[model samples]
Target: MSDISPTGLGLRHSLSLTAGTPVLTLTGIRPAEGIRPGDRLVARSGAVAVLAAETSTLPQAEMVAIGASTLAHGQPDETLLVPADQPLLLRGARAELLYGQSAVVLPARRLLDGQLTRLLRREDVELVTLTFAAPAAIYAGELHPVTRPEPLALTV
Candidate 1:
């Protein structure tokens, strides 16, 4: 697949996995500004999320670059929390991988970057994950996902 996506710039789909491999899932939440419980969240172009548990459905490809629809706005003090021990029910954009025997579940709380580095660096790294839902006006390419991101180093 082409990494030069209009939505995902600089993100390279170099992970050697089948089209339908289960890699990651929506699990937990991290502290961020302007985000609250029920506030719509979505992953930016290159942001990566770590899965906490395994699933029998959902595809792997969908886990690579996840995007979601608007979330139900919550009270200003309300916070959204995802358990580090299960999968989250996210709406908008489909997931290709299901957590299962063949699924690629990294260590609990471990984060996989846009290039899948945290996953490649170590198989047992637990990542702290969060789900971000964007407003209908915000779309991919307009926002950056990863915080401390390493550019994808592709060997052509």
Candidate 2:
């Protein structure tokens, strides 16, 4: 199935399960559902990919590349605190800017800069961290919320 966005960017489709998958379940950081199945993923003409957790269920991803080193390894489903103006290569995953912070949670792919050493050095975003359960630990045929944050308190 082919889906098109209002921006006219053709939604690229890939088999949910491809042959010889390099990474079966991307752990260490939460990945946006866009990187998952049943959705469209897009990146800039020549931008790197950084796996990120999904903050919302939108069909658009926005990112900014501030510098050569702006990607950091993150735990699956964890929020990464980053500085604004930092070069970011975001995949097609819509995100929301949290209050009191300039960091954003958008869909991202893997880092693709040849300067792995340097990039790894400079790209050190603070990761909130997450704990992933093994496939056997997860119960199938059950429904659960994909994203659920801690409840906030309201001060009346």
lDDT for each of the candidates?
0.26, 0.24
Model 2 CA deviation exceeding 4 Å by range: 7-9, 13-22, 25-156
Model 1: CA > 4 A from native: 1-120, 135-143, 146-156
Work out the TM-score per prediction: 0.16, 0.17
In candidate 1, position 13 carries an lDDT of 20
Residue 22, candidate 1: C-alpha displacement in angstroms: 27
